[model samples]
Target chain A: MIDHFALSQAFGLLFASFEPWLWVVPGLLIGLIFGSIPGLQISMAMAVFLPVTFGMDFLQAMLFLTSIFTGGAYGGGVTAILMNIPGSSSSIATAFDGYPMARQGKHNEALGLGLAASVVGAFVGYVLLLLLINPLAALVLKVGPMEMVVVVLWGLTLIATLNDSSLSKGLLAGFFGLMLSQIGMSTTGVMRTSVGNPHLLDGISVVPAMIGIFAASELLRLRGSAYLVQDEAQRDIAFSRILRGVGETFRYPGVLVRGSLIGAVIGAIPGVGSSVANLVSYGEARRTSRTPEIFGKGAPEGVIAAESANSSSEGGSMTALLALGIPGGAATAVLLAAFSFHNIVGGPSFIRNQTEVVYSIILGNLGQVLLLAVIGLLMLRVLGMVVRVPLAYLVPSVLAMCAWGGYGITGTVAGPLTVAAFAALGWLMRRNDYPVAATVIGLLLGRMMEGELVRTLQISNGQPFNYLFERPMALALFVFMLMVLVGAPLLKALRRRKLQQAGR
Target chain B: MTTRFPATHAALLGVVLAISGFILWSAVSASTSLNNLVVVAPVAAVLGVLLPVILASALRKPAREDVGSGAWGDLLLLAGFSAFCLALTHVGFDVATFVFVWAGVVMSGGRGLWQPPLYAAVFTVVLVKGFGSLFPYPMLTLVF
Candidate 1:
């Protein structure tokens, strides 16, 4: 499956100039800073810096963006170890045992363990991507419009049902996003929901809406917070102890590998990315452990499980982006926008045609994983200070940047308006415990889903239901989606009910 | 169980349903073609059914206590952010940004007067100058 000639070309493309390598360290630093801060996300950092990438060539831009992706994975674990607060939702499980470790003065070891696991997870994730891309591309090449529609539905349903919230709320959020995406002129040239505005013709500007949803809303929620970290004493760092923790991670090779594997699989699914992967990995690590009693309180295994899975999920998410041109979550959504910015469409055709470019992007990530280890270790002390920045100062400055960046994108008032409107919508959804990420995934895929469904109907001559029997792949995917959306939950509920009955 | 009525939650759900209904109405009204309502119709129909069930479940459960210092505080900040976005075109980018940051610092609990404005001015100049050069279009600015 490996293309030897393309591999050589990818190597030459990446190493041809020092220019491509120039963006890696800076990208890592930017990601470290952004990911280390509580309430700030890697997606926000990617969105803000997206304008800067406009000047670079495609390879250089990918290097810059993926470096940030790599660095942010480890950067998030930093705050989770140092303070009780996780830098983002993906790091929530890291904070569970990591904070307990920190409270016991094992902060250095916790940081090290998380860092090492992240590096390994990222390495393994990209390695799997390198191995799987060609085959996955060939498989995706066989998919017709009917199969595409089923895949989209599978993604949306998985996103809606997999979250911590009630299924109704998640479905509502996803549905809301899908409906919002329909506000523009359709592919068939029919205007539906623009409400007489010309800007709505092209639909909602996805990037600005993303900034508002991921960045601005979080800033709004953080309005009254004094600092990201409450205590000053927790900011200390030691290099040697961290190295020791890094070395210790290899001792639990099984846990580390399992988490990475789990993360990669879940990360490939749309809407469910690192946030769920980390939790699932942590749960599995706990359930399968010899010493389950030590799982929650300052266990190095817990940190490794959470960090490895979260980091590996990045690679898994990239698989979907590279193979299907579908974003698995917010971060990949930004990457998708970047692909559009460069006028390159990502999917089976792109993967097949631009084999060298695809290989280069994957190879570049492997290098980024190594660089993240060095940069992450050296920068931990500096990054720890991010949590000390007053939220008051951070909030408005980022908001202004969002406004400026939005304007920079559309060159019209609609950009900033979408940012503001979506910011409010996102904040409200977050407040009500709705999954904003589900909404975002829905918005990103809605148009594509509709296009595919429309094509399927036209091809089937309006007997779309009858056509399903002919395409086994689509039928199988539809069944799988139903099983995931309904069967898994029903089984879980049944198990719980049985357990309760036994107790009675 | 003791339950408090969540007006905001109910109102937001209502708004979501209304928006979904409108989109569905628009799609049907725009064209009766299968393509128009192909995706939106089924999704909206499901959403229309699901939201009321959520609303009912929420009505039965106790409302979550506000996590922020107060909802009004966040709302005020959100209002300020909206004004800043709206004013970007009407007012110059520099003037609007400066006013927003300056007011934002004070409202977010900066104790002094000179410091907030100094911080705001410095922030506005750097952001405008840096971003102004980066963007292709000429931005309206009072102070460079």
Candidate 2:
């Protein structure tokens, strides 16, 4: 059923890619550094480097990008543990137990467990990618514009579940995102609300907007806080203790498996991304644990679960990207650009056509896991030193990087300005408990929804219901949306009731 | 007893009602024998207006305590920044960016005199040089 020769060829390509490991290592190192710093995200790093990657060979470019991605995922846990701040959105769940562990002088142990679990999780995800690419590609081919709209709507509804306080606020944030997305030109060639500005013709760049919202807003929020070095007591853990902690991770196989599966499923869904996966997995792990009371009070399983799930999301996201050509998240979207540059069109026909290239990506991803784990473990103390960097210096550096990234995208000042605007908006929304993820989902899916809606409308002439009821695929997607909206709340309520009864 | 209608719900409902009324009027005025805006804009408008109201109404209840005005200043600053972004296309990106960064720092309530000037100088230099190198293609200059 499988082409052994093609797989061998893919391995050869991957081995050949190692010849330029000099370039690859630096990219990985840079990604790691960016990922270790609070408020410095991989997407920002990718956006800044996007223009520079224009001249690189396909394999080299992909290796460089994937190295950044893999290393970044692993690196994000560093700050989440050592500091209360998350290095990236994906590491938010890690902060729950990571910071507590660090506070208890188990820094080395926490970091080691995180690195090991990340590697294992990534390995599992890669195996899943190799196994499922072909069948998944077939499924992806069946997705139409209407299906995409439903998917986006479903993703938006998840925000309602994500926010702890108010569903209305979350929905409002999502709608605002949808409205913001309407600022650019639509697929139907009509600009909805650009107010006659010609620069708005292309539409708002999601990268700059996201960077501003997450990174810049974070900096602004941190302005008044007193920045201090991590307590010196945290640095005293021995190597043997750390190793023992890592050994303890395998004892919790259930946590590892559950977290990885959650990561894989969430990463398979376009627009959801690893960050959401990490949070959901961490929450679920906490809920299901026998010692749920130990969850936020330095639980090693919590660190392992969050880090593994976050890292594993890369494999799942790549599977969706290579098999379907649809990017599962922002970072994967950048990878999609790299693929296009290499003339590698990823779609339902990709595995059948460019099988070797697809396999090479899988091998490269596996290579990255090995490289990051080894490097991360060996340099745990040295990497932990990043916490010493003053926020005043860190903040400016991040802002400058974000500004540079914004400028690179549109090659205009408007890009940086757009970043500033979005950053402020993001800060306010975050303050108000509005979910920024919802906005991102809305912005990402808005164009796809518009294109599908217009096409469906055109085909039906005047009857809107014809698109929903006439097409079986569309009908199925609609039903799926209904299930997501109704079922998720009911399930959540039931879980709450069960937990209450257990407490009683 | 707390009524089902919250203040946010009432506000959202009023906004939706107003939006619906405007859409209906616009649709009536714009409809023609050959083409109708009624078919295109009205349905989306009505849905957009009514859906928010219904959602707000369904979920609404009286607040126990006032939520903190945590980021109101940040919201205003963002609005101002959005305005500044609109200004950039007209005034040349360099000038607009300088003003924008400076204004943002000021509006954010930064006290240091050196901070604004320092950031402004850095931004202007980087933006001008960056734009010149990045866009080697024919520049589409915009003026207000």
lDDT of 2 by residue, A1-504 (tens): 357888999888777645535456777787887677543567756766776677887777787888888878877777667754566657766866886786566777888788888888888778777877776555555665566556545544544443424666656555555555655445655434344556666667665776676566765555443332346554464667667767888989999988887777556666555756786677667655777668767898899889888887888888778877889877888988888877788776887787887787787778777887667766676866544544444444445445544655556766777688677666656554556655655555555455666666676775767666776776886885576557755887799899999999
Per-residue CA lDDT of model 2 for B15-107, tens digit only, reads 434534443344344343212232234334534764666556555544433223434554454565556555555665566656666766555
Clashing pairs in 2: none
Give the CAPRI class of candidate 2. incorrect
Chain B TM-score of every predicted model: 0.89, 0.55
Docking quality (DockQ) for each candidate: 0.56, 0.12
Q: Provide the lowest-lDDT 10-residue window in model 2 chain A.
A: A221-230
**Which candidate has the top score in TM-score?**
1
10 residues in a row with least lDDT, candidate 1 chain A:
A155-164
Query: For model 1, what fraction of the real interface contacts is kept?
Result: 0.67
Segments of candidate 2 deviating more than 4 angstroms? A4-23, A30-65, A72-121, A228-361, A376-401, A430-433, A455-485, A488-504, B1-144
What lDDT does the true structure give each of the candidates? 0.79, 0.65
Docking class of 1: medium
Return the clash pairs for model 1, or none.
none
Interface RMSD (Å), every candidate? 1.9, 6.3
